[model samples]
Target chain A: MASQHTRTVFFISDGTGITAETFGNAILAQFEFKPRHVRLPFIDTVDKAHQVVRQVNHVAEVEGRRPVVFTTLVNVEILQVIEDGCRGMLLDMFGTFVRPLEIELGMKSNHRVGRFSDVSKSKEYHDRIEAINFSLVHDDGQSNRDLDEADVILVGVSRSGKTPTSLYLAMQHGLKAANYPLIPEDFERQQLPSALVPHRKKIFGLTIQPERLSEIRNERRPNSRYASLDNCRMEVAEAEAMMRRAGIRWLSTTTKSIEEIATTILQEIRPERLEY
Target chain B: MASQHTRTVFFISDGTGITAETFGNAILAQFEFKPRHVRLPFIDTVDKAHQVVRQVNHVAEVEGRRPVVFTTLVNVEILQVIEDGCRGMLLDMFGTFVRPLEIELGMKSNHRVGRFSDVSKSKEYHDRIEAINFSLVHDDGQSNRDLDEADVILVGVSRSGKTPTSLYLAMQHGLKAANYPLIPEDFERQQLPSALVPHRKKIFGLTIQPERLSEIRNERRPNSRYASLDNCRMEVAEAEAMMRRAGIRWLSTTTKSIEEIATTILQEIRPERLEY
Candidate 1:
């Protein structure tokens, strides 16, 4: 956000411009000023770079302020066009980091463009997609046919956010996440599900504040025992005890987001499973 | 990668160091430098900031180079500590973006920390989770019970990478993506499945090079007609013809990654759906 004066900022990249905008905004979000961002992607040529500079200068003129430009162009010739043409501050992401990195590694960079996060044709990419499919198919313990196939299995009472948390692990972390919803029947048995028994080492647990669980459940089903605080409290207490008895590690989701829960679980269970 | 001279870099943040690392790496990718990155997260208090500075300064002295810092600290006092104590270039995401944004927006920023990209309790966050769930249930045209509920339905020959593409859409863009595998039987019929007929407008088609499809299929079902190049070629050709006749938009997955394919489809179909 621009404090008293709203200014335009451009995220210019030679490829997707995703890196420029994503990283640039990381810095921008800390600002008091609000920005009107214009993204210019696929600026792979000098002509395209020149065109972007013209537009950037126009924004600066109209706004009566120099617009900030965050660029990730690896091609120095094109980057020079922006540096020379644009009246605003040109923060060259590559230039700032490349020289220092080259000195550190004692070798020249490959000078590749848009190679950091390409996912179309790599084994790692394929593995992540496969992991995501695994999470979806095994969700809510719907099928035990492949319970032994999971990297981490999550168990929690209903409305404790097992599904979303597992999906986060699969989507963001590339981990095979399978979640099981604990019901009264499980409580009655006072034992882990038969299918989960063989894979106890991979199990993780989620618990939530009973009051929050009630509110979340009430959104889906109101005035029912399932959504009742008393029922939630009893279920949560039993579920926690169940996890403890099984020696499965557990975390409370009462005040945490899916990201936090997934990250903590991954850190404690399998550190190398996380991609970024 | 820091080239010859390996140096230590720190991603300093008041909350999770995710933004700093993600964006920092994007810039660092252009260089040949192999950086030794150390993340310092949850530096919320002044005391924590002081401790981090000591560690950062230690790294600088040990390495005998000015360590590069990518910081997302919103607290000016903490930021000042790093600027004054650390011997490095401080890449302040907030410092660079905030003042201009403040002037542009004509309002002082709330000076809050860890506000951007909070996923735990937002409606958009919940929407993404719901979308992921919808994609799993509606996958492979498994059910027509809620075909009309989907934002987009992906149709493709098996092994053409339909499942992963749809899931990426659901996970990244909050699209309720449903995919249906087009089989040889459907190719012979030269029409869409009965379930997809009424909602033809929501369909997007994916086709891959037969050779690539054959290789992918080979991995799934070895030495079978399903994995045959001839079968893959025939199915892909017929699938393309059917999609053309049905007036549906389509793209080739031969040279594109899932991100490119999904992003292009979204751009042509629903450009407004993407957040960045």
Candidate 2:
């Protein structure tokens, strides 16, 4: 238990410790050393803070080493109390993060309180985007569905994650998402899907870094018409032009995770569908 | 904005801020008065924390009132700095929540420094459960070609959100998810799916609060055998007993949102399948 190799991180939050856990996990993934995690959720009072501090002190004493603390608190005084009692390092989530946003929003110091509605609304929008995308892939061409059915509808050339993205959207957001592949033929023909044209407002085109596309294609078939870099560039450019001509909005899927891409699309387009 | 009636919350975290936003939104949903939310993700340094504090101050100025701050920080000293700078109420997310877990685990407090190996392991266990449930649903009397294709599977009495949950899983996880409904006839005959019985290790059952089920059923049918409280209870108990007999693990879905239910199941049954 008292090894020089392992460190313990206490991830605490005002409500559920999930936020700290999620973010902390991602950061930890970036590190080579793995440490232990202690998560505590739903702490809104000073008494709770004191109890937690005592625990931290006990752990430090047993381990014979000072530990770092990563925390999110809703009360300032409670944090002070913990700091006074606990000798180890501590991290405050809100104090370090929200101050700038408050300034940007033109609010006074410590003026912002409570949960932002935008976050939930953004989630809702993302859900809708996912639903739309899922519906496009799994449409089976049978049912005429509502807008809520979409997670995201990706319009782009071959090799984009349209199919996989649509599937991911459905699996992640419970959205009946779908996708439509935008082939070179479609670009040559200068036609968008007839079904999508009416919902042009909902359409979002995906463009990739042409080099990446070429590399991805080369894996499937080298030196072929489909895998040529010049062809990839031409197709991507032409697709962008077609989207611009059609007055459809679009995003670049290059150098982004599926989650990031989906989240950005949801935030920018179809934001109304979000519950928050 | 100067609205005295409203309260504001700032949700600050060291990473994506999604978790804080999620739980915060849940709490906010309980209030009729919608509070303004400001979120800062990826606060890895004390400098970033200072920047956030400035933002909170600005919001306070704009609102012309002191707002409550709800924060999740990784550095305790930074929390102190923000508290010193701000006049509004402060809520420290970590001090309030995770300190106890450190004691329970008998581990030292290491701030913003740990690996979530346990979480990942738990996620793997959850994924296995979901996988088995998915297998039972999508078996389809044909060849079970891809067991890895599942995101989750739900086994329970009919009308337990099995189909909807399967659809949600498929739509959300890109998982070729499936659901196996326990029919009344099957319950009366005291039988389990022969195929599922073989893969009992993967099975997960869903049971609902009888009253809740009755209310949900009452919406579809004013008066019917299917909607009766007595019948619902009997079916629930019998189904649970059958699962226990088969050594299949299960969860109750009563009063949980589909998102909450799905998330809990995914976390408990298929922790390994977590994308993050």
Candidate 3:
């Protein structure tokens, strides 16, 4: 159950306010009380920062409580304005880390406003978009002919976290990722799918604990034999053995987030993927 | 061409380091110079923070200059340790935002360690995973039968940014997003696809400038009607008219980033999507 007492939280950033809110929610989720509400006000300049401070002041006054502000303002002047004008706690992200970084790095931050995809016209943005389109068309082995263009091919049983991992690799790393499911027949034959044999070197296998797999499958098709723990155990065991025999590198997705899984895969393969 | 003058940068976060790096890179990209290198060290405690301070100190000494740090640590003890231990300037995220938040929030933050997806079994974490899987399986109209379960169905012509936007909504917002393409046949008929009739309330249309759509499609199928600007323009015009006549809400993907597009869709539909 949620707590009765709640606090208002604002995640203010000069950018998307995504980073501010991510850390803010992560912190608030740990408290005994839930936040009364949360607002993400993307404040990109001194003018906007002052507007946010006023909003924070208004919220504090109206709620009869002090409001919580989590901000990622990079400009010292803008930050100063908020800190000076606001009557609440200001958790400034750059203030906390930038100075220490400046001392450690022996350089001053350029203090540029948060950069977003306004660079959609740029090559980097297009490359990522291209990769996503490639991934979508190549998804679930739908376009086998284009498989040769993929930097990585992820193969595993249905619902072995292949799709999200593929998309993650595409979105974050700009890698063209194509995924194929190891159907029951492939497990029965105890072989990698024939379409993948030519590109064996690029294949990465994903495995999950049978029990967890069963739980996930049950969510999709409850009470089915496919979701049975025994069936999941057998299929996963067979898939692992097949990949092992083929000398394909594999990772267990049982306990890994998509980020961890994607990072490990990137490290293992080193596909000249985009780092950002 | 890459720049010659460069410096080392570190993205230190008690959590995933994703947000810190996103902001860090955004700021860095604006400069004429490039980072010599970047490091992401996920430090979770006062000890780890101190360790980071030492590493940054070592980098400064070895490089004959201080290192720039972009960080998102939430605890004061950890921040204090890093600030005191390091010989460099400290940019404390929480140091700036938390105090302002505390005054307004009227309560002390629980000071809990940042919990990332490594604590992988949380409900909120699983919701994102589930949504990703749902989106993947339902991607590009893969399973028409399950369309009833989708939070939103993104409809647009091929190469109009529907897939990536749908995937972004799923990955970032824990939204079960299914996308359908408006094929030439649908345009010829000047009507919504019959399968999408029942889900009219949940449909969101994505449109792009014919020039951009032609460019994107040309990358896939060069010198063809599919990639021809004339065809793209005609198809897009017809699709827009059809969607407009059907009262389907739509957005242009030409000028906006995926983040911008997803945010607008969320605001328009309010599909119970997760904010963080």
Candidate 4:
């Protein structure tokens, strides 16, 4: 008989799956054979839980391994489905983590904690949640129409942190921020997005050193057009030129984290539209 | 004949203004009045630097206050611009923060440490930077088509750690993780983006409780449509229904930080397209 396979641990959860993923990854990183991870977010139903079990079984079959499912499910019924279906280990989210909190607080089993319920009571926490919300909704080219609705707009070249910056703006500032990439094509055309041109006042650009861009690009597509030095330089230069001509204010996204970019943009743009 | 007024504080920097914002906000939070903020990100030129000064002046004029500018400019020359234009207190970003860092590292003035500049030759550090780049490009609805191009994709509701999760995925996992908001509209339509539907295998979902949603929403709009409990319940239910019918795999966005979400998504999704 085959040796009992090392358990394939699934850090499943109902939401972002980051917590289980982080603790799970940290634990896995310690081991030589990284136990497999199967995370299922937004699993708020019995059917979904059943589906997750099927997927777990499939992964186990493919790897010829018995897997331990670590999950954070909001609905209790789904947990039952997962426990019943899977033969390997199972870690239920609420049961292991949240239940203790409920017990400690003496709150009901289904006590929910989120921004709206807690905002009036906690300004700092609310601001962080708002910051996260603002960041998630704000995207550059795709969400340009929504740009006007943003508290800030982050403009940057590829890999210059248009996305994370946007997230930071949302997560930290409680400001709605949208980000748009100053793509090679957009630069070649020498035009800001038509929507952005009118709102140039709100536009903030992010550029990084060509060398930095090269290093970042090299990691993805080494020696390719997407990550080439010449291409990056051209894109950066053209993007800068376009920002200059369009009169859209901009910033450089070189060495900063998302938090830095978002805060800076919020400070600079100060969009009146964000007066919620 | 007006008495001297409080100065507006501007935190301008080359990259994201998180550190400056945090420190600045911490200091400001100690104060009772809302301090004016002018943050310029991605500052690579004298012109942009000049614009920031102009904005700072505008704020001062409007508020009838001399603003204290807490800035982090990458280029020293930009500092000169702020100094020339403003009469308020100025805290240079690099001068204040990096000075300590430089002293600690025994590095020269010219030795600038940036996200692109590898701090150490450690694989972990290198991976973190790569992860940040990946998250920057991967916005859910805006850049989901790029999902196939992404190292990972994050799915979640508003404030469910999608943005942070994406950033964490990029900053830690070196995986390009694009995120999309599972909005009420999308759920009401009972459809995922046409693009995401096909990439169901790669999609992840994040769901938080309605009460939590209400808590988050109430902060922005005290009693608006967004913050309504009924709306929250409806949206969460719809999003879950949509996710289930699409047969797209998902994760919850509740009770996790950006770090955990990113890591779990990376392990579970494990997209074929990785960034080097």
lDDT of each: 0.78, 0.60, 0.75, 0.60
How much of the true A–B contact set does each candidate keep?
0.29, 0.04, 0.28, 0.08
Candidate 1: regions farther than 4 A off: A1-10, A31-40, A45-69, A77-92, A99-110, A116-121, A145-149, A222-224, A273-276, B1-10, B33-69, B76-111, B115-121, B274-276
Per-residue CA lDDT of candidate 3, range A1-276, in tens? 023445466776666666666666665644556665554544667887778778788877776666667777767777788899997666665565555555544567777765555655777778888788788788888888878899999999888989888998888777899999998899878888899999998999999999999998998899999999999999898999999999999999987778767866876775233132
Each prediction's TM-score against the native?
A: 0.83, 0.58, 0.82, 0.44
lDDT string, candidate 2, A1-276, tens digits: 557446667776554455556645544443445566676554567888888888888878877777667666656686677778876667665555555435533554442233322322355534543454335335332333553445445678876655444544554444565556677677778888666666676667778889978976886699998899999999998888888999887777665545555555555564432322
What level of docking quality does candidate 3 show? acceptable
Against the true two-chain complex, what DockQ does each candidate achieve? 0.31, 0.11, 0.32, 0.07
Question: What tens-digit string does per-residue lDDT give for candidate 2 at B182-276?
Answer: 76777877877665555555566788878877766775687898999998899898898888877777777664445445555665666544422
Q: Best by DockQ, which number?
A: 3
Candidates 2 and 3, the one with greater lDDT: 3
Question: Model 3's DockQ?
Answer: 0.32
By DockQ rank, best first, the candidates go 3, 1, 2, 4
- TM-score order, best first, reads 1, 3, 2, 4
The true-versus-predicted C-alpha distance at residue B160 of model 3, in Å, is 1.6
